[model samples]
Target: TGYGDDHTREIMRQELRERLIQAEREGRPLRVYCGYDPRTTDLHLGHTITMHKLRQFQEFGHHVIFLIGSFTSLIGDPDDVKAREILTPEKVAENAQTYKEQAFKILDPKKTEVRHNSEWLAELGFLDVIKLAQHFTVQQFLAREGFSNRLEDGNPIYLHEFFYPLMQGYDPIGLKADAQVGGQDQLFNLMAGRQLMQKLGVQPQVVIAMGESLPGTDGIEKMSKSKGNHIALLSEPGQMYTSLMKLPDFAMPLYFKLLLGWSQEDVDDMMVRINRGEVEPQEVKAGMALDITTIFHGREAALQGREFSRKAMQEGGIPDDIAEHVILSDTPLVDLLVVTGLCKSKGDAKRQIQGGGVRRDSDKVTDFDEIVRVTDLPTVLQY
Candidate 1:
């Protein structure tokens, strides 16, 4: 999952290689970790980059820790530029509850060790925080991409924001981690962890900043839940399949590499075949969708996903894989949309229907006051 310019990428690879060798030589499993801020309930496909790496470490017999940033989520990950809406303790706890199960989508649950930062971070006294703060400077934090963007855009960067990296730095020290896996944006935070560990007289961990972020279905910016452009791991097989199929043809190779872990040569060969008309791009995308879905939903579910895509997408027919939301009693179509998690709210559902974006079977939904029926139990709401 390592990513960056060639030189930096090579350095990270070499570092990880050496660390693994040392782990074998020392006859002790190297402690490897990746931290996730529990800011949301759903674990999206984009979030699985390091999770796959952590699984690799588990395969290699290294200790893998899946750390939940219960405390950090409140402060927000400084990697994202926008000011954060701090979550309440209740909200953070609720989100954390689902992380382990969702993470099992890629990680081996039995081999993985889970933790919440609040276990230790909440106990830190002011002096303890000051001691942690001494390792980094304002200039360094400001230089980070996210903070840099905020500064250049004249956005208010809060004082606690600077402490995020420092707090993250202390994670490795607390766990005595020997390596960290993270997104490209998290290189700064991982390096901070390395520095903090070294200061504490512990060996610095190897940092693997996984490859460049995958673009959203829009095929432009990185996938973000807020942008409504991410595929959540918790999404149904049909949802995942349809989402991946939404990418531009240009991004298929990247998806093949990032999501499927295919090599450059293989991706290039596949593209060459597609360019030569030796294979249909739609058929190739269907295979890509199936491969990804199988990882989370299994082969049977994946096959269903493929069939659904072929019918709903290719033949203008309803997908058999659509979740059956039984209507025990009648309700407004808008209310059903909100209930099924298809739309964010009843108002948004009504707006979509009015804008001709929502459809039932072959008919466009034009009325917000449309009532549902038991016959519509097998309904397909397309947006």
Candidate 2:
């Protein structure tokens, strides 16, 4: 996706084909890898796009490395406009632990090689960094959109931010990678690896393949956790199904193509049917939601999730088996929402009430500060 044009994509395709032929002649599987920084504990659907690519390589009998950026994540990726908050080593470790487990949902655990970049990045000393930095010019870094935006806005671009590319570039050398897969935004870092390999006397024949970035629920912006527009890989089947069902109609075709692996022609035909009134968009969306949810939570759970969503929507009531939570009397309504996991925080609960999205049974919750006294016991709470 980051190839920019058809010409560039064709070049990469030709290069990959040539590399495969060469690897076969030498009687060795090609080494392919994609790096992920464990900035958060849970990975969203956006993160799985590259993993699906890695899975394709696995099926082709290529060696795949799921590289975790243990060290580089401390500085974070300079992909954002502003500098990122540095994470503690403890927090990084905690987040890294869950990444592999979640990634296994898409990648083959037996064929995948899990590696931490800290093995080599942490070993680089002062002199080693200086030698690595000498290869790149400051103008090159400034040319990047993220850095340039920060520069034009007079924002501080920390010195450590520049080192991210250098560290990421060094990862291929450490693993002796033959190819790397990443999203389009990581083109700069992927190219950096190719440049470093050539400069450092390692094999410079690294094929860089970048996939298209997935848009969030908004159907416009990139799917992100901070934006609250992401569906986590580990989300419960019901939650995942509900989330996918809520996607804007325009976003369905892309989800069909990317997540469901439907051909572009198929997607266009489905849209055509909807436009002609031959098929309903909601039915199509429900199928998409079910198929995608099944990928992570299995068919049975996905079926149940579909049923749950149907009851909640068409019937305007929750399922009979929905989880039950007991609350004490005199509990503040806002506090009750958070404790019962209905909302993320007290502030979120209050916002829901103010927005008229919260309810106690059939009655709307109009006041955020309302108290649940003994008389309110056994009442159904909904949001």
Candidate 3:
């Protein structure tokens, strides 16, 4: 597929391969596109699945278009979600800028054609919109699992949500994309593109759907920054490394395959080694984190992340990256940790202090009621 090894092009189907072949034979780069909504300012591990596919397409010498959904974000996408929250134009624009910047860290900038859907979407008059709407119906969207589930659950599915797939389908037609890349959840939207193009008197392009999304540490919901269950690209090296270290061991290999672009054979071998107890899962996970961070922040940053984590764990103290609070005006130890963002909950702070996990200036504290006063020299507290 796309002149790459089999594993590298797992998502590209035979029909898509044929289309790519015809484009190559004619000395043209097949137009391929993926749409990203600006619902969040930072991209998490979840967003990288399609980004990796886009990178593979770029490596295959195809014309890759990254469409920033500035227009669609205003309407919001309810696919695989139960609720829709419309975003303001200003917020959408700001998020779009950040999305492009973070995305370019993985995608080749020179080979990538970055675009804003607002260019065409905003210019559509009533008549033009009517014509585009003629290509699909409400019944089609209701058939989607996301919508059907809401209907069965007594949840309200808004009208704007119905327009998401239509707007997405219009994106491919606007770009004249030979293929669209998306995760398996977007199969409906991807098919919507093919159908829309067919109605517009053009040949329907191929749909390239990736595997399921990478679950977060919870190993349940998709990795999402809003849920505070994401390993974000914008996170500091130390924070990113620590969060990755906390992932459930069972989810490690899946994360490696999806986020690190590890080959199927290599992943299989690692699994075999895991079964044989020859290679520790933690070691493999560390390598996975390094390979992934290296792609975005360079090998040096990856090494730094690994080293910082290793040292912190070895020392049995909080990572230096956690905020330090000056002990001013006699504050309870638990309060200090909570105020400094060191601990998320008061109960957690008390547990750490009781369990001898909390430390002040490298000395373990035995009492949760301990209070300290502010001084010129800051007290390093851990929870």
Clashes of each: 0, 0, 3
lDDT of 1 by residue, 1-383 (tens): 12257887787779878987887899999898899888887778888878888998899888999999988888777645677787897899998887998899899988999998888888999999988888788888777877888899988898878878888888887787888889887878888887888787888888888867877888887887777788888776666888787778888887888888899999999999999999999889878989999999899877776665555766445554455354557888899898888899988997888789888866899988998885443346777
The segments of candidate 1 whose C-alpha lies over 4 angstroms from its true place after superposition are 1-11, 79-81, 314-338, 341-383
The CA lDDT of each predicted structure is 0.81, 0.84, 0.77
My TM-score estimates for the predictions, one after another, are 0.82, 0.83, 0.79
lDDT of 2: 0.84
Could you give me the TM-score of model 3 versus the true structure?
Answer: 0.79
Candidates by lDDT, descending order: 2, 1, 3
Q: Could you tell which candidate, 1 or 2, scores higher by TM-score?
A: 2
Give the least accurate 10-residue stretch of model 2, judged by summed lDDT: 320-329
Name the top TM-score candidate: 2
- Give the better candidate number (2 or 3) by lDDT: 2
Q: Rank the candidates by TM-score, best first.
A: 2, 1, 3
RMSD of 1: 5.7
Q: What is the lDDT of residue 335 in candidate 3?
A: 80
Q: Which tens-of-lDDT digit does each residue in 347-368 have in candidate 2?
A: 8998899999997865899987
